[model samples]
Every structure is written in C-alpha cells, then in structure tokens.
Target: MTQRICGQVVRVEGPAFRVRGTDGTEWHGVVRGRLKKGKRTATAPVCIGDEVEVTPLSEGQAVIERVLPRRTCLVRRTPLGGRRTHGKAPPVQVLAANVDVVVIVVPAPAVRSTVIDRFLQVASSGGVQPVLCVNKMDLVPEPAARQHVAEVVTPYIRSGIPVVLTSAATRQGVDELAALLRGNLVAFIGPSGAGKTSLLNALCPGLDLRTREVDARGRGRHTTTTSAIYDIGGALVVDTPGLREVAFALDEKDAGDPLLLFEDIAGLAARSRFQDCSHVHEPGCAVKAAVACGELDEARYREYLRLRRALERSPSD
Candidate 1:
C-alpha cells in the first residue's frame, strides 16, 4: 500500500521535482498526468514553493497527486512562439508560489527602469510585495556614479517601495537586506549578472553557489539555470535564473487599466478631467500635466506608457 503525504516543492527541473515531505523526508517526484493536463493558463502546473500531495512509491521516489491552492504566485508572460492553444496567446509561466516578497535585483551602474517597472507590475498583480535590490554597488565606487544610481531609483522610493543598495563582495547593505527577508519566503529575480546567487552566498556564507562574470557588452552571463528554494538563516529564499524580458500575463479585467502597480500614475489619473483619459493627447490629463511640469519623473512616465501600450497589444485568450 502506498502512503500519501504532504510536501513542499523545493526545486523544479523540467518534469522532475524535489519535494521535502512534512516528515523531513526528501522525495524525487513527477506530477500525475491528470494534474499536468488540467485547463490552466500556466505553462507548468507546478513550481518552486508549491505545497503538494504525493504518494510514495518506493525508495525516495513519489508521484505528485495534487497541488494545493496557492495563496500567492509570481508569473510572467510566456515568450512569443511558445506552445499555443488553437493559435491563441501563449500561456503564463509560473515562477514561484506562496511567496511573501518578490525582490527585483539590478546591478549598479546598469540599472534598467523599464525592466524594474515590468517586474513591479507582475508582483503587484500577483498580490506579492515588491522590493528593489540594487546589487554590485562595488562596481560604482565613484561618488558621482553612486549618486546616479540613487537618482535612478528615487521614483521607486517615492512610490513607497523599499530599495536596498547592496554589494555582495563588500557586504554593503547585506544586514538590511537580511532583515527584510528574515522569516519570509522571498524570491529574487532580475536580469543576468545581477548577483542573485552572490547575494545568497553573502547572506548564508558557505553555500558558495556558482558565479559568472558579465560579458564584454555588460550583459550578464546566465549563472543559475534553474529555480530552487534554500533555507538561508531564517528566510526561505528562491533564487531563479536571470530573465531577459519580463512581459506579464494579465487577466481580461486588468487589461483595461495596466497601471495597478504605478501608484503615482494611477493617483494622477484619478484626478484627470476626462474619465477615460489616455494621458496621451487627452485634454486636461492630469498625468500628462504632471509629467510636463516635472512633478513626476519623466523616465518613469515614459516607461509606464511603453508598458501600457505593450499590454494593449497583448492577446487575451
């Protein structure tokens, strides 16, 4: 007779999963066919940090029977040309489930506001708190360079998001970062070369994960190829592979207004004279006025428009 037990999926590698059972046993498992074929919009039915039921077969192998409902999930739009249903839009990719926070890490001297905005939207939409982690501060040793980085993140700070500047090599701001992550399940995400793994090493000290240097073009070489959960200090940290693009999946209801994460813009929009103001050529648009008068960060406003247009073009299937 097979014994059924509950476990949390700690790592996902293609069709294989590593689940840590409630009894402290580790099981290598695969999802049941029925669960895999369910009518879900997610590319994969299982992800790291998911609670699941498994039936132990023999040795350390098990079959994942069911996935418990997720309290929160981090997701992104599947890349174009992926598997489609009747030529419909691509499904979303579930990155992690039941996460308390999504940390968007970016390297100093190369901060990209567009990427940060996209990640913020997805985290907010998924009901997870978002924190900005500026890593590799050692790369920006000059005072002017450091100030430049500060200016880049000022808008996010003004929007009430927590921003931490860290350098894995020098241990700068590691204590503060650790404080925010203590006792919480946090997922670190960012483009390649942002030092997610390095920060993890700095925080846990001795779990020396792999590290790769950025290319000559200043692009990060992929170091972490898979997503996995680690128990670091008092925090459960999920370290994921670097992402090149962060397109978000949106529900039909959310398609009309994609500014849910942009509080500054949303607040201004509420005061617009026209109820349906697009903030582009609409007369008396509060958002546009704010941008023109320097009341709002112009770069952030431009990125918001870019994201809105991208969402408008997204296919809802």
Candidate 2:
C-alpha cells in the first residue's frame, strides 16, 4: 500500500483536483472510486477548502482517497436559468468548504441589496462570518453614486455587519480589506462584474486573476470559470466562478431568519404579541410598529421581507 498523506484541496476542475499539504507541497490527483461511490451532499465530491487524504502514485500525480469532514460549507443549487441539465434533479453545489469568512463583493454604483441579502443568508445559515466589500468605489466618486451605494448597504452596517468600501483601481481600502481577511480561510464570492478577481490581484500584487469589463447592458462578462484557492499574505483565499444569482437550498426547518441580520428587528421580535407572529398581518407586531413609527427603516424591513419570501420559496423547501 502506498503511504497516504493528508492535504487540503485548493481547486477542483472536473474530475481532477489540486491538493496542498502542510509542508507546502502540492499534488495533482483524481478522486478515488470510494468517494464517487459514497453519498455526497453536493454535486462535486470535493470542493475548494476541503481536506482530504491523498495517495501518491508516481511523479507529481496522486489519488484522493477520502474526504475529511467539513466544519462549514456554503452550498447552492445548480444554474437552472441558462443551460438545462436534461431534467435531472439539480445537484447541490458546494461553493466552498470549511470557510471562516465569506466576503461578498459588489461593485459600487450598481450594488443590489437583495443580492447582498441573499449571500448574507447563506453565510449566516452556514454558521460563518460575512463581510460585504463594495469594490470600484473610485470609479463612482460622484455624490449620486455614493448615495446609491450607501443606501443599498446602510441596513447591513446598522445590523452589525462589517461593510468595507474598496477600490482595487486606486488601492483604496485595499489594506483594510486585506487585514480583515488575514490569518483566515476566506471565500470571495460575488456576481460576474463585481471585480472579485481584480480585487484579489490588487491585494496580492502578482496573483494575475483574470478580469473583464461589463457589457453595455450592465451585465458582466464571466472572467472566472472554476473555483481555485490561493495564498495571500498567509491567508487562504478561495476564489469561485462568478455567480449571476444565488439560489438558496434551505430546508423549511433551517431557513435563515432575515430579521436575525437586523439587530433592531430581531430585538423587537421578542416583544411581539404572538410568538408565532409572521410580522406581516398579525396585531401587536413590534416589527411592524417599528417600521410604521419610523423607528426602523421601512425599506430595510421590506428587504428583510423579500429575503424571507425567497427563503420560503427555496427549492429545498
């Protein structure tokens, strides 16, 4: 029997994966049959940030024998809007495993609170910390642009979430962002045009992560096609393909509470007249009262409601 070594998967493309050991050695390997035969929670048996046991074969090649248990995992459903997978049940896609922090990157002047809320739900549900990074701020220095970005992200800030305004172009907030991600396994996730790759390059200098410009229709061209991991100043960063949308796979019993992200609303919920109040039509709803009385921003409350509806309609439900 060949000696087995413990390693962490840095990337997975098709059936092959790149695993890095503690000694800084790397191996290219294919998943062994046992992993394929066993039941898997996600579409891919191995994902970026997974720890596994590898068996060396010859040269630089090896075989992934076993997958270690994951402490945290960010999961989502397959892309159903674009290409059809032939009526097959959408397999769960694990974006990253064992992540300490999830960095949601959004381009300034074009940020969408709904999208950010969805990512926050995933991070919160997965039991990991989430940091919202607004990139390309330098490109949108106009007061109107600043206002738009501020309006979209203010609720999250008020809810105790850390929001970093960064500009990869001008190096604005780059150091601050890097400090936050240091000494942890951070997964960088965002929409296609959100400047994720560019930001990584800015932080690490020579990462050379590919980047592209948004089209005239305000849609970003896909720059990253696969998930990969990199080391940036001792931090393990997992970079994933650009996501056009994040569809939740939450179970009804495990659906994340949007109000939980809102400190004020969550605190008021405890005082609702009905323990099971949905906060929409029930009387004596403290949440509703707060919104009506301007104690809480109505727009923020509405976004919370929108997130709740999305979770309720999750495919897993």
TM-score of each: 0.90, 0.92
lDDT of 1 by residue, 1-317 (tens): 77689999999887999999877899999999999888987888899999999998888999999999999988888866566567676788988999999899998978867778778877887889999999999999999999999988988898889999999999999999999999999999988888999999999999989999989998989989788999998999998888877776667678646678788899999999999888889899999999999998888787678878877776666
**Candidate 2 residue spans exceeding 4 A from truth:** 82-89, 292-295
Tens digits of per-residue lDDT, candidate 2, 1-317, equal: 78899999998887789999889889998999878888765677888899999998987789999889899989877776744455554666889999999999988868888788777877877777999999999989789889989988888887888899999999999999999999999999988899999999998998898888999998889988878889897788999988888877564566555665666788889999999888889999999999999988888788878877876666553
Please give the RMSD of candidate 1 to the true structure: 2.3
lDDT of 1: 0.88
Pick the TM-score winner.
2
Residue range with the least summed lDDT across 10 consecutive positions in model 2: 82-91
Deviation of model 1 at 149, angstroms: 1.0
